[model samples]
Target: MTTIGILGAGQLGKMLAEAAAELGFKTHVFAPDADPVAAAAATHFTQADYEDIKALQKFAASVDVITLEFENVPVAPLKKLATPIYPSPAALEISQHRVREKTLANSLGIETAPFAAVRSPEELRRAMETVGVPGILKTCTLGYDGKGQWKVATPADAPPLPPGDYIYEGFVQFDKEISVIVARGTGGEIQCFEPVENMHRNHILHTTTAPANISAEIAAKAIHTATTLANALEVAGLLAVEMFITRDGHVLMNEMAPRPHNSGHWTLDGCNVSQFEQAIRAVTGMKLIAPKRTAEKVVMTNLIGDEVNHLESWKKPGAHIHMYGKKESRPGRKMGHVTILSPRD
Candidate 1:
């Protein structure tokens, strides 16, 4: 059996492991955690820190193909692997850094929010003048789930952050935040899922509704942009493109993820082919089917922290509960998520 290796052992890796089993593919999960959630379903588990080059090399050798579930892992070492790593190092390099991701998006003729880079107090002042107040200050690297970022609502509130460089982005006047999860095979076949409208609590994703209330023109643009990015980056696996839909109906690139993203989790039960399957197919040199939306209205709610602990409250019919089997949880931690397919009320 062909074995696929994943570089992270979080919920994303768990979901991917489950999907791989269904498709008759073995999954090898490599991570530093002693008991990663994915290891339950993983065909092979290699617990090693990201810095352990020897362990990584051994894990890479055991799998037929390799892909990463998280983009935060550095791309330098993974590039030296023998097997093909889907989405490629170029894609990881771009998505891992916010400044590079946004800059590449803008260079592709894709419009994003007005922004500037700040590496020092002086640069922060210049970025403030350019992007104005009510901007988001995000670290160029290692920022996810609203961590390593801050919001500057007013000029006076801009903190004296001179430790490291960050990216300053002017807030987009958006009606709603939407995302499109697109998959591209090794041969350039692309499959685009219906846009998903997202709601965030404390800058962390709270819920997602599929078939986003976007015009066909805007949706088309989103798909086109995602496809362009996949090809441009020579990405060989699934890619999730997040966009800020302006009040005027224009789609502005917000960010891109080089893996099975949180926004696409609904696909597990809301589509014939889940995002995990798509990622596996794309990386294994198989054809990626154009995703068919399973629910007319797919609504997904993230069960974060204590939210997942209250499992009794989510017993509503037609609700799919997927607990991540997490041993512990903390505030703002992503414990699990639930997806519901019901009428759009």
Candidate 2:
């Protein structure tokens, strides 16, 4: 049996391990968390810091191919590994930094919110002039789920500059936020899931409606943007592209995650192939499967914070509930999700 190595033992890792097992592959998880949630599902677990070269080497030697559940994993250590890792370190590096990601998208002629790199107050001021006010100042690296982000409604709102590179991005007057999950094979073939509409509360994803209520033209454009980025980045795994549809119906790229995404959780119940399975298949050099929706419509609602407590209430016909097995529930923390498929009329 081929062993799949997974980095970052979070809920995403747990799902990946479960998916790999379903495909008759064993999974070995490596992470720094002493009691990682993913360890229980994986066949083997290695608790080590991301920067520990010796531990990473040992872990790499044990698995046939390596893949990551999240993009924040340190790229430097993974670069030294002899094992083949999907979505390459170069792609991971670009996804980690906002500046690099945005620059790459713009260079591809993909539309994105106006943005400028900010290193100092002076540069931030210039960025405000270039990107405009009503923008957001976000750390170039390590920012997610609204963390490491500061809203710049005006110049005076700029707080004491933090100690990292930042990118100031102009906000778009978007009508809806949507995301597409594209799986690319080692041979460069791309398969895309239908675009899904996302709703957020406090900058954390709250709900996703699959087969977004949009014209076929708009949906096609969204998928085009996602596949374009995945091909441009040479991504060999799943790439989830979050995009915004402006009031004028134009699609502007928002962000990209080179792994299974929270938005794609709907696939677990609504599609023939889940995003987790796609990630594993892509890294293992398997042919990609077109994500055919098994349901007419699917709505995935996140169980956030204490929301997981009501898991029992969500159990019903056409409803698939998934709990991440997290011990504690904190505000804005993703505990699990419930994917509900709408009955066809």
lDDT of each: 0.86, 0.92
TM-score of candidate 1 against the unseen true structure: 0.96
Worst-scoring 10-residue span by lDDT in model 1: 153-162
In model 1, residue pairs whose N, Cα or C atoms come closer than 3 Å (at least 3 residues apart or on different chains), thus clashing, are: none
TM-score of 2: 0.98
**lDDT tens digits by residue: candidate 1, 45-85:** 99988878889899988999889898888787888888888
lDDT (10s digit) by residue, model 2, range 1-345: 399999999999999999999999999999999988999999999999999999999999999989999789899989999998888999999988999999999999999999999899989889999878799999998888999888887777888976679999997889999999999998898899999999999999999998899889999999999999999989999999999998888999989999999999999999999999998889898888888998889999999999987878998999999999999999989999999999778
Root-mean-square deviation per candidate? 1.7, 1.0
Candidate 1: Cα lDDT at 23: 83
- At residue 67, what lDDT does model 2 achieve? 91
Worst 10 residues of 2 by lDDT: 155-164
Tell me how far candidate 1 lies from the true structure as C-alpha RMSD in angstroms: 1.7
* Candidate 1, superposed: residue stretches over 4 Å from native: 153-156, 160-162, 343-345
